[model samples]
Target: MVIRVRDLVKRYGNLTALDHLDLDVQAGEIFGLLGPNGSGKTTAIHCILSLLTFEQGTIDVFDCEMTPDAYELKQNIGVVMQNVAVFDELTVYDNIDYFCGLYISDKAKRKQLVQEAIDLVALNDFVKFYPKKLSGGLLRRLNIACGIAHQPRLIIMDEPTVAVDPQSRNNILEGIKKLNQAGATILYTSHYMEEVEQICSRIMILDKGRVIRTGTKEELKATISLGEKITIEVENLPSHILENIKTNPHIATFDYDDHVLVARFIRGENGLVDLLELMNSSHLQLGRVYSELPTLNDVFLELTGKELRD
Candidate 1:
């Protein structure tokens, strides 16, 4: 394991931030740690990096016990937090070079690494631009470049795509894949389900400082009571067709509103075919039909109730 967190616990006076959380991340895999706001995602990260002192348990990085002053281990780890940490006064090149210099002291090697990070984030054109001059997306890219410029083997990115343009989001995701391909193990945390689904090889969803589910996306989905969700749009959904779909054993629940029939199937082998056949036999004109498998969001909602968790 590249990172192992066992029985990890953190407390802030009376509130428990991490409730004996157990986590493991393998080498060369993009692992996603997903949760809602204040679900202990940040706490777990802080504990792992030794930034905040945890109440109990052990955190191991690079197959050894981690320490706050583990400079050798820290050198191999790169962290890009949710907040932008680059200096507003510094240009893009300077920001990246400064962070890279922390790990690599040799001027010749540091220059090459810094330039590579700039190229990786596609910031070549904006190397001289300060943070204030850049758009939200460009600023995010620069933040990433600063973190990964040192070419750390382990990269931890916390909500790196928050409030960024779609194009920059795509660039960041692609850059992450390239980094993993080049042998960097990444721990990515985000509230965006699709981003985690797109990039992570394995996912762990937490709620209220505890892990609810952890597995490959397929594995996690298999554990849930939700299967495929079929959506069909029609000119007008008849009451009979809606009732029939709702009454079907394969389907768990259905919603009909504004000429759209949405059926959620908890379990079934041929849900798609069965749904289509029923709709066609009932003389319901299907304008658009889409069948989607259970997503990471569904799994999270299932494990943690829809009720709000602080």
Candidate 2:
């Protein structure tokens, strides 16, 4: 295992940030950690990195205990947090070089690593530009470059793509895949469900400092009670048709409003065909019809309630 935590607990006065949380991340996989605003995600990460002391449980990285002074273990790990950390006085090139120098001392070796980091983040053109002159996207790229310049075996990225342009986000996502292909394990956390579904090999949803669900996207979706969602646009959906859909054994939920009919089917049900047959027999004027499979967002919202979190 790349990372393992058992019965982890963290408290802040009377509030429990983490409650006996258990987690495991294997090597050669992009493990996604997801949670709401206050869901112990950050606390768990901080404890795993030994930046914060926990009340109970053990955290092991590379099959060894993790400690604050574990320099050798820390050397093999790289972290790119949500907040940007770089020297504003230094240029892009200098910023990357400064960070890379922390892990490497030889001037020649450091020079090569710095150049690789610049190229990896596509900041060659802005090498001489100060951070103040760079855009938000470019600055985020620089932050990532500084973190991965040493090419650690494990990389933890927390919302690296947050508040960036679409182009920059795509570039970062591609770079993550490249890094993973080059034999670096990644622990990624993001609020964007699409991005997690796109790159994560396995996902774990956390709530109230505990694991709510953990599995592949397909497996998680399968555990939900929802299946395909069928939507149809009609001039007027009669009450009788809506009642029929609501009473159907295959449909778990039904809603019709604003000249549109939406029906959510139970998992493993062939409700679409039946609904189409019914619509055709009724001779209802259909403007548009579409069927959408359950997505990661659906699974997330269902498992973790749709209430707002602080």
Candidate 3:
């Protein structure tokens, strides 16, 4: 296991940030940690990194106990947090060099590693530019380079792509895959569901500091009561047809409004064929039809209430 936590508990006065949470992340996988704001995702990460003291439970990394003074263990771990951390006075190359220098002493080796980091993040053109002169996307790339320049075995990225442009987001995602392919275990946390769905090998969804579900995307979707959703545009949907759809056993829920009809099917039920047959038999005019499979967002919303979290 790359990371293991058992019965972890964290409290802030009367509020419990983490309530006996247990988690495991395997090697050579992009493990996605997803949760709403204040859902203990950041707290759990802080505890695992030994940056915060927990009231109860243990944290282990690479099969060894994690501690604030575990310098050797810390050396093998790289962290890229949501906020960018770099020197305003230092240029791009200098910032990366400084972070890498913390783990490497050999001047020649550190130089090579810094260049590789720059190349990895495509920061060669901006190497001489100070952070104040770089765009938000370029600055984020620099932050990632600084964190991974030493090439640690484990990388923990918390919202690395936050507030970046689409091009920059794509670049960062591609870089993450490359780093994983080069033998780095990644612990990724993001609010963007599509990013997690795109890159995560396995995912764990948390709510109110508790693990709601953990599995592959397919497995998680399978556990939900939702299946495919079909939407059709129909002019003046008949009252009887609407009543028939509402009473259909295969349809878990449905809504008809403004000349459009949307039906959500129960898992393991194929309502599309049946619904189309009904529409054809009724000779109802159909404008457009769309079928969409259940997505990670749907699973998340279903398992965790749709209420907005702070």
- How does model 1 score by TM-score? 0.95
Model 1 lDDT tens row, 7-114: 998999999889999999999999999888888888888889999998899999999889988998999999999989999989999999989888999999999999
Any residue pairs clashing in model 3, and if so which? none
lDDT of 1: 0.89
The count of backbone overlaps in candidate 1 is 0
Error of 3 at 181 (Å): 0.8
Sort every candidate by lDDT, greatest first: 3, 1, 2
Against the correct fold, how does model 2 do in TM-score? 0.95
lDDT of 2 at 287: 88
Model 2 residue 31 lDDT score: 94
Tens digits of per-residue lDDT, candidate 2, 1-310, equal 9999999999999899999998889999999987776788778888989989999999999999999998888888988878899999999999999988898889999999899888888999999999999999999999999989999899889888889999999999988898899898999887677788889999988777878899998999999999999999987777787778878999998888899889999999868888988888789889889999998778877887663122
Q: Which candidate is the best by lDDT?
A: 3
